[model samples]
Target: MSKILDAFLNENLQNLRDQGLYNEIDAVEGANGPVITINGKQLINLSSNNYLGLATNEELKQVAKDAIDRYGVGAGAVRTINGTMDLHVKLEEKLAEFKGTEAAISYQSGFNCNMAAISAVMDKNDAILSDQLNHASIIDGCRLSKAKIIAYNHSDMEDLRAKAKEAKESGLYNKIMVITDGVFSMDGDIAKLPEIVEIAKEFDLITYVDDAHGSGVTGKGKGTVKHFGLEKEIDFQIGTLSKAIGVVGGYVAGKKNLIDWLKVRSRPFLFSTAVTPGDVAAITRALQMIMDSTELHDKLWENGDYLKAGLKKLGFNIGASETPITPCIIGDEKLTQTFSRRLVEEGVYAKAIVFPTVPKGTGRVRNMPIASHTKEMLDNALAIYEKVGKELGVI
Candidate 1:
């Protein structure tokens, strides 16, 4: 390696470590459920995105096994080539049904979905009105499109309306689109989609919603668009099969023309190999389960409420989260990392989130309470939290 490159790397690494912003990842020993093992130590897990605990569901496991036996593992090629298998087609159909859309298209992952969908539709001649706090993937996608990105304040409807009106009246771009996450994962706040839709209509802007964190947890498992009954109003309904569906892939559900266009124009779909047979089969089944009943969804909310109440009662600064994703706000980065480390030492596994993922100075330990967590687990975790909070002087 060149001396200049080595110096640059070393300087950056030291800076991150000195500022307490370097995140060290720990590997989970077993299934990422309510409890997990790291470094041979058992801890109550509040860090997983497995909102419904469906990742370890026995029935889904069996379904995946059967699919692997029948179709083997890989899809063999890219979609436009020879990789579009029957399982892929079936999953897309199910996605369309679940999102209440005319048709849908699947991608290798949620990040890929954004990268493909955004750039495929928008270009330098267009503009995208994005939320200030939208996910990184959306940001990268907009950049890839070479579109003029206008960021509105996070969930501030008036700001969005003002920006939309400006972009429309200016007539500087041929097409304009408004994009946001259905639920902001970091703060757990639901997007003002109803108000956003109203603004979009006033400005004649296209609407796009990425409901990665809201699919299995909101709108009776239909998602945030359905939460506000905007199924017909929104143009693009994007989501991940990993977070709530307990599988690995992403999709964009919309009108038939859009799906058809993506099939031909989206680079990821044309270039990337399709999702494996087992994962696709399991994703389809998981969507069916979410559609069939609200048992898991209801239980997840119950646990979320329980944990939030416990944390609040203990005097932790739990942010204003509308969904089950909880963040215990600790202002200083070093203290936040220390708080998370102490929790792990005491038998709870909540990870610290700091700069870049969220803004600087608003560091936090984000908790994800799922359906599988019992009263005992929550109570114990709460007890450990109180101890850590007191020791760290965070409460």
Candidate 2:
């Protein structure tokens, strides 16, 4: 009830509203699949990160229910205590195998995984070379480590090499780490990991790749690192169970020594409650499925290509994306928001990305086409896009 606090919040919120930068959340009436119902209206969903469409897979749902029936609904304590159940242990094992690592450690969420893992290994005596376009979680994790954070140009390996060489030759830090996202989410661009790994070798830098968006989508579902067959070369490979795995939680997969060290030092694992039995069981099942078949992965890319081609045919400036994530560039924030709003009104559910999330004048409506989307749904969404794009003079 402090007046100053209230005024500060009110003023900032008002500023956001005045500039049309404030976002309003829409609640889905049922399961978040390729098609979702929002406020009594059915929409062709293109905003979700359900890349492989496993989030609503019937088999995964059944497995989760069975786990709940057998193990109850929650992890009773932090992982360092009695909460490290058989399910948790099994999930870690599956993660290690799925990622082609010696061992792995899990956390409650992807954000927490970064925060816990980075700070656990790197500190003030270390320096981290990060991508300028890396995810926000990586930035926060580097900050928490209290290390010297040096940012290289986005996906520019030359810039990264220069910074890496400079940092390595400085001889001021005990360790130097290079961290980047395997796939840039907002722009849907895969990172140049192969070149990065080669550079890391020349400098003896500890390499970390956060493959949150790449898991179950790239490398035939093994991820970006394995996509280039550098699985063993990268020191730390971080993944999330939430995105394409279609469940929840995050993990760090590496050597046994690294996993063992994380178990002893990661603050989130030591202090926060573990993922539930149902989540662990479901995640394990999902990984097993992803490893077994590439059907969903292929279907996902099919839809992505279908949608992108349609958008391009209609004269929309879809960005240069190498993944299933498609961004229709609008270039102006207000118009971009208007475009998204009109799309929703016309039964599409893609959202706009503007300043703070993406650089200014690069505003876009990002579309994530999953395996569950039918050709019919994509066609309808395209129809809506053509109508809105033309009306807004964007095409």
Candidate 3:
């Protein structure tokens, strides 16, 4: 550690290493798609969030290449300057239409989008009613806003309603907002948006939904907000282009005024260079693919159901997943890590996620089944899981 650096940094890292929590990242030799090549091994990749299999799509790649040829590699400066390209404006327009919102604003990344949007609307005098298991980005955004953060039990509408009523009655904040992930990334649990909308209406709370994993995978490929039929009610429909959208960047779709406010106030939007034309074009095309039909979405779900059933049949506790993301729940962290390592050794590329990504004792090997997976590939992976689970006595 540098002598001038904050003392707490190394202390926390040391604590993590002492607790056997330090992770060593594995590098993929080639691009990661349905299958990945790491360490000269082609493994059945069940660890990516490439839900619709668009991450490696030739169509998206060609679109990106075309944009690069036409617009160059970068957006010259921050958006307020000259960075806002025609593709950027077009992407935002397409995104708003895709999310059924009046207007939208793009960001450098999903993490920055959270930091930007939350603080843009919320402040020290405001309060944020956040879901307990929401993404770390959401947590950090709330912290940066300097808003009083009150966590409600995960997807517990009753708890949310009670907290909202109490916050309103207390008069502690100038404005109150409820923030949640449309679908939890780890457990793949869908948010109860209809109930949340009702609660938000009862309390007049500003509603925000980060649908990063939900877009192109839910609501017949529209998103979670559309799936729940609450498109107009959610004040902020946050999403990312990197995951299912198969590109880099994030955006917030909402009322024209809210987006207009964010454009002027959000620090990241003001400071960071805008998304490049290539990424913008790529993501716009990806959204078009999703909206065209449920072909890829259906294939993803088919693969998800097959893999979940196979793991359960092997006595591996696959958690309550409603989406393509499935977690084979393992009780111990070390054992879960070992299990994933063994799976890799056997040509399966599932990764283990433990606390504090998920609850303690609920450590899991999260699998992301993509539309690109063949039934034969799925069957092979299941056989490997059975072999590994039996060897580890985890079944």
- Candidate 2 residue runs with Cα over 4 Å from true position: none
The true-versus-predicted C-alpha distance at residue 26 of model 3, in Å, is 0.9
* Regions more than 4 Å wrong, model 1: none
Write down the worst ten-residue block by lDDT for model 3.
15-24
How far does residue 281 in candidate 1 sit from its true spot (Å)?
0.4
RMSD of each: 0.7, 0.8, 1.7
lDDT of 1 by residue, 1-395 (tens): 99999999999999999988999999989898999999999999999999999999999999999999999999999998889999999999999999999999999899999999999999999999999999999999999999999999999999899989899999899999999999999999999999998998888999999999999999998999999999999999999999988878899999999999999999999998999999999999999999999999999999999999999999998888999999999989999999999999999999999998999999999999999999999999999999989988888
Question: What would the TM-score be for candidate 1 when compared with the true structure?
Answer: 0.99
lDDT of each: 0.95, 0.93, 0.91
How well is each residue in 24-99 modelled by candidate 3, as lDDT tens digits? 6999988888789998989999988888888899999999999999999999899999999888888899999999
Of models 1 and 3, which has the larger TM-score? 1
TM-score for every candidate vs. truth?
Answer: 0.99, 0.99, 0.97
Between 1 and 2, whose lDDT is larger?
Answer: 1
Error of 1 at 353 (Å): 0.3
